[model samples]
Target: MKALTTYIISQTKLPEVSVKNTIELLNEDCTIPFISRYRKERTGNLDEVQIGDIVKFKEQFEALEKRKIAILKALEEQGVLTPELKQKIEATLDLTTLEDLYLPYKKSRKTKAETARQHGLEPLAKIIMSQNANDVESIAFKYVKGEIASVEDALEGARHIISEWINERTDIRNNIRQQLERFAMISTKVVKTKADDENAQKFRDYFDWEESLSRIPSHRLLAILRAESEGFIKTKIQIDDDKALDKIESRIIRSNNECSEQIQIAIQDAYKRLLLPSLSNEALQIAKTKADESAISVFAKNLKQLLLGSPLGEKRILAIDPGFRSGCKLVCLDAQGGLLYNETIYPHPPQNDSMGAIKKISSLTEAYKIEAIAIGNGTASRETEAIIRKIHFKNEIQVFVVSEAGASIYSASKIARDEFPNYDVTVRGSVSIGRRLQDPLAELVKIDAKSIGVGQYQHDVDQTKLKKELDVVVESCVNAVGVNINTASASLLSYVSGIGPKLAENMVSYRDENGAFTSRNDIKKVPRLGGKAFEQGAAFLRIKEAKNPLDDSAVHPERYDLVKQMAKDLGKSVQDLIGNAETLKKIDLKKYCTESVGLPTLQDIIKELEKPGLDIREQAKVFTFNQNIKKINDLHEGQLLPGIVNNITNFGCFVDVGIKESGLIHVSNLSDGFVKDVNEHVSLHQQIIVKVLEVDVPRKRIQLKLHT
Candidate 1:
């Protein structure tokens, strides 16, 4: 118990308040969301992930402590537990090391050790190990009983016992493993099989390559291991066997010539039979596990970057999902993403007349004040853009071809179908593509984030762990953006703090039964959303109209009264005081600060009021460039190209420059200065201008540069 607590303390490095609060909340069976909200002061405002990690680690420690106690009790019952052994076991920090130390006392498989013990040759084995045997044959012959009739038989039986003794020494094995791991090289070669001896189709590139164990990249190691497992390659590591034997003899066996030779053979035999299999498998597993960890980390990082990518804010947009067979499905939405009009037009079809498409565009733009057109970049997307560009309207509206990677997924989803029951799937997809440009957070929540395609090695990583981590990232992003209570569907609302499927359904039902909720107070009237749920969720829920003006602001409704009092103290109405530049310029927030409203809290309130729920979406910057580049070969070195960052990986960022392919800006070319993490340099969907550095059309590779 003491060791468990110490490990937790050492590993977390969490403040005392956080440690105590996490333990207490975990003890109370409170969920991560509940603790993050209701017990913020106790946990020092630890976020959900930190709380979850602490809980998981603490649970592991408790389980290990229970197992440790059980092991001690079992050994005591067996009457073989010495005080020194007990103390050593208690002091062991890692469970793996402790179990290795106790391997001799644990149950054994049907092995040479058990067979030798049955033949009563263990005493002779120990005597030989003592190395006082001036005559080695004479010493072993003494243990020759009925079963062990000859010196050769007795010696053979004794070797088995000695090998077990060597294998049981945890300290020796641990040392040898460390040495081999550092000194060995993993070599992989294509298998020379009768099926395809010279061809080596699967492992052609890796037919002859060797990497030092310590220097091998995780991905490369996994690739080789997988290739070998599939029978496409042969892989093995070469170690200094003589060095290993010498080390084992120095540590365990006595320094006598005859005993040393026998012990060396025994150690070598044990290594081949026991240690090699265990250590090699362990090394490979470690390599694979590290690779998986790296893959998971990259995926999680990419997911977070994608989920939190800047939204485009609210804007009047005309969305069009282009198709050759079905024609084009057009949907118009206002600044708030409420569907205003929907229709289908065949611009490039049997009719082939531009008049029909022009008339539809002009009517929609005039009727809905369409400021921009978000066309899906699918089949006929460019052709659709060309048709729209020729049309004449009152205002000059910009046209953008959206990625539309997961638009169909969102359109076919249950949430999308629920939201737009009257519309066809194509119409729904058009609306999704348009709304994604308007507010990515509100629209993207309907689709699985994985389908959005901003992950690295996602398919190969642990799917369960990857899903859990990505789901958490999605939830954090959703809550951080703050969903619109009225327009948000149940799927979106479920991501809100303290709201799940049932409560979200109840909320939608209540909203439907009773019009849009105008204030945070109305949430309590929803069925099953009691006081505790309200207390946890009310802060994040915003209302356009409320008695207390701060409710419309990001300032939680719980702090509404205090903000109102401060406004009143300054002889100003709460509404006029918050966003009013003239009044806000005159009033200093420091004058109204109290014990509850520290400098941090006061500054946050001031900032919140300055821009209440300020959307972090970047305004789309329109660029007009020459449509001259069609193929990769038409590019020249140092040619400036406008592109959008499609994805960012550890090595580089992929930029889509309106071509058939994407170009890579290696980590080296990201900037003139050294870069550690890619996100710090570039993020998802960021429109950047880069210069082409190299292009290999045969390999379909393009190297780009962001630096001038």
Candidate 2:
């Protein structure tokens, strides 16, 4: 374990104890699910994110070790093995770094070195490099009688040979590569032909931008690179090779001699012809790789926040997909997300019926005892909110504007069709818009996450890699917040660790064959859901009205016996001891210690007993706004306007006010006082209330004040 820890830390740039602690816990034969959930004490309470990092680090370390062994064996076979070389190879972390060390020994392309060796010019080139020769061109004449005809040809041939010798020097190439990477500037220019392309327009702003290779933001770099690849722009890294070569040559050759100029020329030519392209390629690739990694990390962060966005809990909600020219689509769903009502209201249309629409909404709110009204933050949303707010309902209800980011995509999806076959697309969309607010997990599974628009550059990223990463994230989130076994749809159930589509369907089939799961143990009867599967997934599958309360909580069944043992030690039945607060208080759970169970596990158990199937919801919840106030002229100084944060740049944030336009809240207007980064003040999806400070109706833009 210590050896593995050293290896992982050295190879992965991870801390030593992180790997050591992780491997030690894994050696105890705890499952990923178990270690992540119950063995928090052993793993230092490392969350799923940290555990996943450890897993990746371990895999990469092992793979690198295998590669190192292969490289060492191959080098030993070539009979160039040295203790120093072996140590350097073993110590190297990056594959590129190791490859840099081994480039001299690696197989080559057609080069002047092989040609010179064939023509017998290597000895002459060597003589010239040694600077022992009075004149290199004169010395080369001795070997140039038959093949090298003229002094010019012989010098040219010998120069090629000497240049190849210079190129083969790994130290020189490595030094030059390092220098170029540090000083190069990444410059992108928009291609002139495609300036009018719709996608090209977004990148037009970046076409003429320049940034140092080291400092460009990952998002902007990727966006620019993607635009260039799509033929909307052209990009290149500009480096002054003359300046770079001068520094390198001066550092390498300190002595002033007649042969120094020749050597310097050879070095410069070798760099320009042989080493620069490969090194620039490497540097660019590294830059791109770092950018890609940063973007993915940001994407993962945003996605986790978006996916775990507060679930409103199970509630009957009336959804309104608002439209102006067309009528508003109204959908009402039961607490379990089953659609109960579908109707349309022409509040503002050819057959405008504002009062009639109000009456219909009022009637449904009263008849269904609607708990909330979910209004889509699209067209006519604020008008619908206004109308719904005016209606007097016998039942108390709250109105929320739900983000309809992927609601349209879900409505047009095959799953949506299967769920709502008789309804029109608009009605299905309205229901999805509502259900997303009621339970984000259950409804979100129906739509592709990339379409949800929470991530930047999700579409342009490596699709397979993105899907694998996002699927893991979704699964982690779904299981972390345990699912309701009986009510969860197959789409939702498939996200469970061990339950794929077929198994999810089988579980549902088994339930249909028998009845609702009365106990967590009954899940074993479901075909393909064997003991190992149960061990991984059972803890996250909650059974409402189950025989054991612990089963509904995140407590694994293996620990059930331990809980019972605790109850026995307390001279009370397990059921009585679980809810018996007085007895539980008296019992020191640290006394029930095992190799796996500790303070964290015992405390989790006590908390679970308090609320067996607690669904933690967000507090002080806010909703999305559909209306936009585009122009500053259209708003009074004190008017409060609902706005969507469109773009967050260095200066300020741009918000889309519903007038088919947008407004900017300058950095000064962002607060009562000073602000640094716009991202610190607002995020991409945040819906904020802004006061209109200044209006430019001619430009169709508004200046907003966020302070008040």
Candidate 3:
């Protein structure tokens, strides 16, 4: 445990106390968001990302320890647990090193070497390995009894065993692994049968691609792997075979003798029959894992940005899930996102009722006092927006094109069905679009993060790992922007610090039965929500109109007394001090700091007092796309057009330029200067102007350069 802590601290470069405290909290089953937000004092004010790193490194060290234990036990059971070998295993921290040390003793299916050992040719094999024997055939002849018929057969068996021995050497395996890492190239070729297939054309860029494994971009690697998985391409890791053999020979071949020549043969055999194939696959897997992590990181970042996107706040929004033949599904949502009304309108082709649709929108806006209109960016979206634009209501309504990526999926989900059981999918979807405009994080939590479509290679990455990372991101975002306990749905509440799905459902059920929570303490009445859960969650759960003003702020209940004391010392009520920035600034944070509540927490409390329940996200602004350019065909070279950065990748970012086919602003074009990270220049949902560089209509590919 101490070693683990030291390793984590070294890796994270975090204070030892904070790392230890974080590890303890994690061991106590605290969520990352909980520790990051409420336990800031214990963790030295580490944010969610730093806390998450500590958790990740701690888990990795624990996994390594578990592997160590398993390896030790296996070696002990096999009666090969020599003190020196055990010391080596115990001392090594690298998993690959430990595995290599264990490889010789691991039981496996009978191979050529195992068969040779069974033929009582162990002595001959050792003699060749020593590389000190002259006239090795004579030495091999001595072992030509029983299953070994002749000197030639004896030498063959000896070489087989020697090859296995060479394959199992720890130094040999490590050296070869290093070689593969430094010099290997990932090469891909189109499958012969799929060469002319239309489906394979998507991967034609990789048909004869070869690049150093270490230098390949994560997106390209994932694409190649996905193409290979779909049977459109064949991929392999390539290395200089002679160079690899020479490396092994230099390590194993120590002398020039009859046995040295045989040892050379075994080296080649070991590499060909075992090491090359095994290490190639291992290198590829390591590369893939790295690529997955990179891709998942990008996905997580994009998800965070999208989830924390500018919310329109509590507004009466009229949302439309636009369609042509099926008409537009429209829903009116009140300030709290409660569905007030829903209907269908056709202002588009096949069943155009433009006047009726315009009249209906105006009437609904006037009746419901709608402040905003959220139109789904789907089929007939721009047309619907144009129609709505023509409707001159009594009040100016803010119109927005909401990315309806996962609205349909959420609408059809069980949660959606439960939320609007009487309504159909279209109505539910429209409500989602409207609610998203009001609160993206709250509504997005109800849908799977991947389905939200702000990612690259989301489906191709490891699902379990992707979910874990995304869950962390969601939890961070949810806790970052505190949840409204009285109004938050189960899906949104589930992401709150310590609240899981069950606790969320219980809270919702309790809210339903007991009415809106009047105080933070009221949360404890919910079933199965114990003291610890309340402690971890209460600060992040906002109780609007609560008796205690602090209940509506980020300041925890435990610190309510301290704040009250501060107010009392000031000869004022807590409510009087709340949001009083002048009063907050007058309070000496250092004077309030204690052993557990340090300057960081006290400062945070002070900040919270100045702006009670302040949301960190910005307000959603209205963006206009180039109305003249609706399709890819309308785009011409050097044309400047407004676009939204929908997705960002390591290589570049994909921009939605008012078309079905998004344009790629490659990283090189992101800035006039050398650009390393695409995110540094652009982010998900960022509105920017891009100049069309090239367009391939057949491929539906658009090349765009950022309008600097």
Top lDDT hit: 3
Per-model C-alpha lDDT, please? 0.76, 0.75, 0.90
Sorting all predicted structures by lDDT, with the top scorer first, yields 3, 1, 2
Query: Higher-TM-score candidate among 2 and 3?
Result: 3
**Model 1 error, position 361 (Å):** 4.6
Cα lDDT tens digits, model 2, 455-556, are 567777777667766777778778777889898888888888667788898988888789799888898989878776787678889998677777778777
- Candidate number achieving the greatest TM-score relative to the actual structure: 3
The TM-score of predicted model 1 comes to 0.84
lDDT of 2 at 101: 73
Taking the tens digit of each residue's C-alpha lDDT, what string does model 1 give over 414-519?
8888888988778888998898777677777778877887755566566776777677777777766677788787877887777877999999999999999978
TM-score of decoy 2? 0.85
RMSD of 2: 4.2
For model 3, where is the 10-residue window of minimal lDDT?
31-40
Q: Provide the TM-score for each candidate, comma-separated.
A: 0.84, 0.85, 0.97
